[model samples]
Target: NNPKKTGPTLNETFLGLLYPTENYKVYGYLTNTKVKFILVTTDLDVRDADVRNFFRRFHSAYVDAVSNPFHVPGKKITSRTFAERVSTIVKSFGLSTAV
Candidate 1:
């Protein structure tokens, strides 16, 4: 591996933590086209890698949802594929073995 690269490329999809609260924290990811994703969790000790993985998987689901030829632009996503993927991602949050 090239020593120059430390980790995954800073892909615009998984923007890190936005803010933290006493009981929980909120993270954000904003797409270049302005779609936004938010994740709030009570687990303050969660790792950045885990959060990144969550958003990356969620973003992939969103992308796949809108990739259909018949999908209308600007319409809300109701795809089952996206729903299932997101459900699994959310349920597996903070689990190192999830990936």
Candidate 2:
């Protein structure tokens, strides 16, 4: 792999947050520590229920795919397993179920 083409070296925190590098399309709601719910969206048009579904999906993806061990320390992520995990999450947390 070309060092320059791979982009500059990033810190460990940044690298850790970038595991299982699969691209995803997500939609959901974010609840902060203050208990405020913030709506999130994607390029796709979705219903309230769909948003909930997406929220769950994103949560799973963030937990599983973005936390895989096989993923490299500082390289582009491209894992089919990661994509599958995200897909499952998306379906389960679809925005259509958002309240």
Candidate 3:
């Protein structure tokens, strides 16, 4: 039933070719440093431009975090401030999920 099984997976192809699946839509941005930023949204009507904007903002925040002299690169981000900043950014986009 999954169309992905009939063809190449996202990891096997270019990021630009990836599309939405049944239950969720995936958008990806691959950085020159090989860092991949992915966003999964349940709203199928979401436009590509919105996704691009989200990635742009996220990449900026990520860079700020990694650029800190005290922050180590390639390690799990454990900074509470960074986590809060990311959460705030996501919420600012009105993408918060309610249980």
Candidate 4:
């Protein structure tokens, strides 16, 4: 007999954790074999500078922060870990943005 495998896709897990409050508007579709894309729209207006900074910081966080192996699946995300990662990104980018 084969053991049952259970879990959500990475996209689902990402969105579930990213939009727990349902405050974000995401419009995009991703298949298991294709690259995932997420488009976010919020009520609060985002300035060009803020958007640029966010991307820079996000890239930094993705690189210098999250463990590469854990980025795959079934990994628990913690607030403190997230905060630290964001902080690292901000510092690396020389931004004063609070994460």
Candidate 5:
């Protein structure tokens, strides 16, 4: 039972962890295919506009992953490209600003 291969790796594909630290919040989404997405994140002080954009980008990533011919519906997403996209989304949480 290797930790790397333990359980469905979908949890990691979301954000590299099953859950975040204390004071975090959880969000959910239901895809057209009945796929449910739940994610936890530390309380963020991001702007409303940023939050919308963030979800949009995240959803885009998920769609791309599922669209992969090798991906099996309702199964763990093992695409390295998907994981890297998630990492990038989390890293670029917020960098743009205007006044």
Candidate 6:
């Protein structure tokens, strides 16, 4: 009944831990600064290289977001520009924006 609880609990394990559930694959990337990026995909054939590329592009967007003069570090991202950039990047990979 609590399927949502599993993801966060597994995420606490560590960076780079790929946790596979019955219908999805959860991938993780942790920066040296401890910023966690989690990617959940239903495509079983998704390759690690593609995941790495996605994270790289996402990281670039994240950097640009944080570099803004008005941006506050460690706070939730509320920038529309950053969201649009990330959505575009994700769409380029033929992935849906729902996630």
* lDDT against the true structure, each candidate: 0.84, 0.45, 0.71, 0.46, 0.66, 0.76
Using TM-score as the yardstick, the better of models 3 and 5 is 3
Clashes of each: 0, 19, 0, 0, 0, 0
Ordered from best to worst TM-score, the candidate numbers read 1, 6, 3, 5, 2, 4
Model 5, residue 66: C-alpha shift (Å): 0.4
Q: All candidates' TM-scores?
A: 0.81, 0.37, 0.72, 0.33, 0.61, 0.72
> Each model's RMSD to truth, in Å?
3.1, 15.5, 9.4, 13.1, 13.3, 10.7
Clash pairs, candidate 6, are: none
Q: After TM-score superposition, what is the CA distance of residue 19 in candidate 3 from its true location, in Å?
A: 3.0
Least accurate stretch of 10 residues (summed lDDT) in model 5? 11-20
Q: 1-99 in candidate 2: lDDT tens per residue?
A: 675575324321111111222343432234332222233334343454455445554555655653688777456557787678766754555333335
Question: Which segments of candidate 6 are over 4 A away from where they belong?
Answer: 1-17, 94-99
Candidate 3: regions farther than 4 A off: 1-17, 94-99
Candidate 4, residue 59: CA error in Å?
Answer: 1.2
Best by TM-score: 1
What candidate 2 gets wrong by more than 4 Å, as runs, is 1-45, 73-75, 87-99
**Worst window of 10 by summed lDDT in candidate 2:** 12-21
Candidate 5's displacement at residue 15, Å, is 20
Task: Kindly provide the TM-score of model 2 when superposed on the true structure, using C-alpha atoms.
Answer: 0.37
Which residue runs of candidate 5 sit more than 4 Å off their true CA positions?
1-22, 25-34, 97-99
Query: Which is the winner by lDDT between candidate 1 and candidate 5?
Result: 1
Best by the lDDT measure: 1
Q: In candidate 1, how many Å is residue 90 off?
A: 0.8
Instruction: Summarize candidate 4's per-residue lDDT along 1-99 as a digit string, tens digits.
Output: 335755544444122223323464443434333434354655334343444455545544444434555555435445466678767654554334477
